[model samples]
Target: MAVVSLEGLSKRYGNHLAVDDVSFDVGDREVMGLLGPNGSGKTTILRTLTGYLRPTAGIVRVAGFDVVQEGRLARRRIGYVPEDAPLYPQMRVNEFLAFMGRLRGLDGQKLDVSLGLARKRLGLEDVGETIIGRLSRGYRQRVCLAQAVLHEPDLLVLDEPTNGLDPRQIIEFRTLIRSLAEHCAIVVSSHILAEIARLADRVAILLDGRLLAVRQVKASGSIRLRARTDLAPGIVSALRTAMAGVEIAEAPQAGGMVSLHVSTAEDGAVDQVIARLAAAGIGIVEMSEAGADLEETFLAVTSRKAFH
Candidate 1:
């Protein structure tokens, strides 16, 4: 079953609808990237998922529990880190984490084990006695993350997690997020397109309070094929017809030659593409495996005139 599910979820404030019938799911151990611009309702959706804001319509479920009817139970399975993490500057790192753990109902031996694990995972062992106010921005963010996972929630929600961090810090944060995903599902809401492309297994794009598209960010056994021939409409159609279930797209290249990117999880997909191209008398100048271009997909979806 999906770790998190949203069906026809909508949220409104007065006459303004912040989210409009947005629906998606985050599977177990999956990292879902939520992408959008300002006023696109990314934060609103996260709030609703975490049981902070009751939905104005439809249902939100986490681990089979309705967010509204079973708010407490659903919330207990989730750990949320908002854009600006709520922290106490006066307290030490260890002290703050312990307090948050207690708030989550951790106690005695369980609390001690949880605290130790959180500190170890977040690299906070050396900073245990350091005052939160004296820590750097990156360290503070780590502390916030540590507190969130103290109880090992089934789902973790992070909003603009790498904001205000340096390049090195951002890289470190990405690694930490990937490690966390090994044990639980994660929902990352961020404006950074590149980060989402790297971290998420799939991406859901939101625009103007509506869902634009949900796209896969990673593909196995994908290949990029470049041909010297000009790109014709028939060529693309023929390729698709030849390789069922394979995703094919024309990628922009600096040279005059046409570039096609093909992706599929099926075995021998490359050999099939080669044979099909040969059969079609299409000359292949170059062919090699390539990763998904999420930016291209994002642009195509958001730039549609109908959406505007």
Candidate 2:
């Protein structure tokens, strides 16, 4: 069963349709990435899911509880970390978590256990008694995540979770996200294509308050081919013949090696292209699935005009 479900969900303000008929589900152990430009209704959709705003139309359920009708119950099953997580600068890490736990109706040993587990999972052991204002930006983000998961919610929602973190912090944040996904469903919203590609199992693209496409990100489809010889007419012809809709372009040469950027619209094109090259004896020095980068894919999806 889906831990989080939204069917025909729409939210409007006056004449503007901020979210139009947005619908999707997040199951156990799934990380759903929400992608869109500014004013695309990603934050509005997330707020609706968390029961902070009543949708203008459509149904939303979290852990089988209706967000509109049973908001209190529904909210208990969700963990939300907004772009700017409000933190009390005066409070210590453990003190703040304890306060949040009590608000969630946790007390006594249960609250202690929850706080302990959250600290360990989020690598906050050293900062338990540290003041919130004194922690670094990365540690602050970790605290936000720790508080979100403290209640053991069934679904976790994060908006631009890595916005200001450094490179190393971003990597550590990604690790924490992956670790959190082991027990609950996660919905992350980000404009950074690389972050979504690295952290999410599936990506849902939103454009003008409408869902454009949901893509299954895999490692084997992005093919980068390098040539031992110059990208000659013969090599280009062989590639075009072997793979339809393959995009090939010249790349910077390294160590006197000719390089070509090859992109395929379909999977398994790499194998066929490699075989055809060998038959015609076109030197293929290196060919591998390119590392995870979804910038091109995001542009391809979002560039299309949305239907009225």
Candidate 3:
């Protein structure tokens, strides 16, 4: 069910190496978030995937077609929405979509059906006759998506699809992306961390032209263990000895609490560690899971080199 695959894909400028031996497989019906800071080579990777730029090395496959060798087939099967979606300013929405559909080799009832679906799914039904220049930025983005998907491409490549959208528009965009999950594989690249955590089925963080980490949308194992001891010595050593992989995360004497983040190999180790410390004469004030969210994970991994 792998719809898109990139192995050792690399691109470089004259003196600077951009994407270095980057590789990953995108499965069917997946919404993958591509994350990175500015100038992190994210745009380069997307451009290469869309065939706007040929890679200096490695292979890229979209819907079982090689991006370079079978360039036409690959391009035909992919719906690419760049950060700045190209739209003819004077063209009417429906007219532009029809033109785009024709370019994709879609015609007759089949093409009509595709347009219908795009309009309904992307909430562009009422704006069909509006000129592109008069539409709001959010609606314009939707129009861009409508054009990209007017022919129902099998693989959707969206680079910062929700970049300039308002909060309401951002939510609507997320809903549209989730609904499209049944038909095509999607790759959405954005620097907004929270949005990725909420919308992505998986996440890949890129930095300085390299992929730092790739992860599923599973909840990270996180805990905030507060050290509370009535005695003067504190429970610092007790924490270190009893809990493996536990580090001092926060310690506030005014609050009479010392918070530590515990990372253990096995599951449910937090409760056990807390029980052990309590049994050994240490006091427990409060225990809760901190924000080990995707943003935190993205920051942690991307700050370092690639973790494979």
Superposition TM-score, candidate 3 onto the true structure:
0.76
lDDT for each candidate structure = 0.87, 0.84, 0.80
For model 3, residues 180-209, the per-residue Cα lDDT tens digits are: 877888988888776776667898788888
Off by over 4 Å in 1: 219-292, 305-308
Best-to-worst ranking by lDDT: 1, 2, 3
Model 1, residue 157: C-alpha shift (Å): 0.3
Residue 256, candidate 2: C-alpha displacement in angstroms: 9.1
Residues 1-308 of candidate 1 have per-residue lDDT tens digits of: 99999999989999999999989999999999999898999999999999889999999999999999999999999999999989999999999999999999999999999999999998999999999999999999999999999999999999999999997688778889989999899999988887887678999999888899989885346778776547535456666888777777776667677787787665445556666776887677788756547878888989863131
Each prediction's total of clashing residue pairs, residues at least 3 apart in sequence or on different chains, is 0, 0, 0
Error of 2 at 300 (Å): 3.0
Please name the candidate that would achieve the greatest TM-score relative to the true structure: 2
Question: Which pairs clash in the backbone of model 3?
Answer: none
Sort every candidate by TM-score, greatest first: 2, 1, 3
* lDDT string, candidate 2, 128-210, tens digits: 99999999999988898988998999999999999999976887788789899998999999887767877888888898898
Would you list the clashing residue pairs of candidate 2?
none
TM-score of each: 0.77, 0.78, 0.76
